[model samples]
Target: MSEALLDIRNLELRYGAAVAVRDISLQVHPGQLVAVIGNNGAGKSSMVRGATGLVRPSGGQVIFRGEDTTRLPANKKVARGLVMVPEGRLLFPGQTVEDNLILGAYVHGGIKTPRSKATLQRVLELFPRLRERLHQQAGSMSGGEQQMLAIARGLMAEPELLVIDELSLGLAPKIVDQLIGVLADLNRTGLTILLVEQLASYALAIAHTAYVVANGRISHHGPSAELARDPEVMEAFLGRKKTAA
Candidate 1:
C-alpha cells in the first residue's frame, strides 16, 4: 500500500481557553480525494488552520510526506507543496488576475522561471475564463469567477495536496457544479485533495472517503457513498442532530 500523503494524529487546537478541535485525526493517502463535511462552527475551518500551519496546534502532529510539519508556518507549508485555497476567496482585489497568479508563484521565485511559467500556463488552461480576464481587477469579477481565480492562484504553487475550504460558499448551483467538475478532473490526473465543505452532497460526489465532523470531533467516517446513504448524515445536514454516525 502507498504511504499516506498527509496525516493528522490526535490534533488539538485551542483559542485561548476554549478548545476548537479536540483529538481530531485524519489521513489522506496518495491520489485520493477525501472530504470533511460539517455545518458551520463545526471546527472544520479550525482543523484546516492547524493542519496548514495558519494556527499552531496545541497538540498532535501534522505529518506531510512522512515529515513532521506541525510547527511550520503557512509559507513553509506552501513551499513544501501543501497549499490551501482559503475561505472567502481571498484574492488581491485591487490587483489584476495575472498579478495575483504571479504572486501565487512567489515560492518558486515568481513566474519568471521556466518551470513556473509553464505551470502558470497550465493553470490558465485549467481555468480559461481566468485567461480572458488576466488583466482585469480580481474584485470586479462575479463570485464564481473570483472563487475560480482563488483556486487557480493556489494551483500556481504546484501543490502535492490541495486543501480547499468552503468551495461552494457564495455561488449559484450551476457554478458550484462546474467548479466541482474541475476538481474531479484534477483529482483524476493524480492530485490528492482534502476538501473541507459544508455541502455534503457535492463533496461526497467526488470523494472516495469522507469524515463527518461534529462538535470538533469526527463523529462518523467511511466511504463517501455509504456516508451519503447513512440516515445520520442526512439528519446532521438537516440540523436534526448535533452529532452523526
Candidate 2:
C-alpha cells in the first residue's frame, strides 16, 4: 500500500474550556480522497482547522509525511504543501482573480519559478471560467465562481495534501456537481484530499474513505461505499433512511 500522506491520532481541540474536537483519529493515504461528513457544529471544521495548524490541538498529534507537526504554525504547514481552502470561500474580495491566485504561491516567496506558472496554467485549465475573469475583482463573482476561485487559488500552492471545507455551500446543485467533478479529477491525479462536507451523497460519490463525526468525535470510519450503506452513518449525517435508488 502507498504510505499515508497524513495522519491524525487522538486529536483534540478546545475553545477556552469547551472542547470543539475530541480524540479524533484518521489517516489519508497518498492520492486518496477522504471525506468527513457531519452536520453543522459537529466539529468537522474544528478538525480541519486543527490539522492545518489553525487551531492548536489541546492534545494528540498531527503527523504529516511521517513527521510530527502538532505544533507547527499554519504558514509552515503551507510551505510543507498542506493547504486549506477554508469555509465561506475566503478570498481577497477587492483583489483581481490573478492577484488572489498569485497570493496562493506566496509560500514560495516571489521566486517566479516555472513551477508556479505551470501550476497557474493548470488551474486555469481545470477552471476555464477563471481564465476569462483573471482581471475581474473576486468580490464581483457569483458565489459559485468565488468558491471556484478559492479552490483554484489553493491549487496554485501545489499541495500534497489539500483540505477543503464545504464545497457545496450556498450554490445550485449543478454548480456543486461541477466543482466536485474538478476535485475528483484532482484526486485521481494523485493529490490527497481531505474534504469536509455536509452533502453526504455527493461527497461519498467521489471519496475513497469516509468518516462521520458527531458531538465532537469521530463516530464512524470506513470505505466510502460501506459507510454509505451503513445505517449508523446515514442516521448520524443524513438523519433519515437512505431511500433505495
Candidate 3:
C-alpha cells in the first residue's frame, strides 16, 4: 500500500480537563474511503477537528502528505487539500447558495481562476438542485437540500482528502442513502474520504475499512465488511441482538 495521505499518531484531545480523545492513532490512504462509527459522545468530531486543524491537538502529530501539520490552522489545512463538511451543515444561513460555494473556494482564490471555475461547473453537475438554487438562501432549503449544498461546498475546495462529520445526522433515511451513494461515487473517482457517521450500517456498507470508537477510544479496527458481520460489533453499535448459534 502507498504511504498514508493523512496519518494521525497517538492523538490526545481535551476540552478544559475533559479528555475527549485518548491516544488515538489512524491512517487514511489515497483513494480509500474510511469510516469512523460510534454512538453519541464518542469524540469522533473532536478527533476530526484536531486532524483538520480546526482545534490544535492537546497532544498528537497530524501528518499530511508527509509534512507535520499538527499546529497549522484550519484554513492552512484546507489550502493544503484537507477539507471538512462539519456537523450541522454549518452553511451561511442568510447567504445565497452561490455565495456559500464561492466562500468555500476563498482559500483557492474565490472561483475567479479558470481551475476554480471548472470546479464550480463540476460541482453543479453533481448536485443539480444546487444549480437550481444558486441564488436561493442556503437556510431556506429543506434539510436534504441543505445537506447536498454542504457537500457541494466542500467539493468547491477541490479537496484531496474530504473529512465529513455526521453525514446522516437528522436527515431522512432516503436522503442519507442518496448522500451515501454520492460519496461512494466520489471515492470511485479517486477522492479520498473519511466519514464519521452515527449510523454504523450505512457507513460500514460504503467504507473499505472501519474503526469503531467508544468512550473516546478505538475499540475495533478491521475491514468494514468483516466488522459489519462481527456479532460483537453489530450488537454494540448497530443495536442488533445476537441470536443463538
Model 2 Cα lDDT, one tens digit per residue, 139-221 = 99999999999998898888989999999989888998888998999998888999999988889989999999888898888
Q: What TM-score fits each model?
A: 0.96, 0.96, 0.97
Model 1 regions more than 4 Å off: 239-245
Q: What is model 1's C-alpha RMSD?
A: 3.0
In Å, residue 71's CA in model 2 sits off its true spot by 0.4
Cα error, residue 31 of model 1, in Å, equals 0.3
By summed lDDT, which 10 consecutive residues of candidate 2 come out lowest?
236-245
- lDDT (C-alpha, whole model) for all candidates: 0.93, 0.90, 0.92
lDDT of 1 at 221: 91
Per-residue lDDT of model 1, residues 1-245, tens digit only: 68899999999999999999998999999999999999899999999999999999999999999999999999999999999999997899999999999999999899999999999999999999999999999999999999999999999999999999999998887998899999999999999999998988889889999998898999999999899888868767853223444
Ranking by lDDT: 1, 3, 2
Better by TM-score, candidate 2 or 1: 1
Better of 1 and 2 by lDDT: 1
| Model 1: how far residue 156 lies from native, Å | 0.4
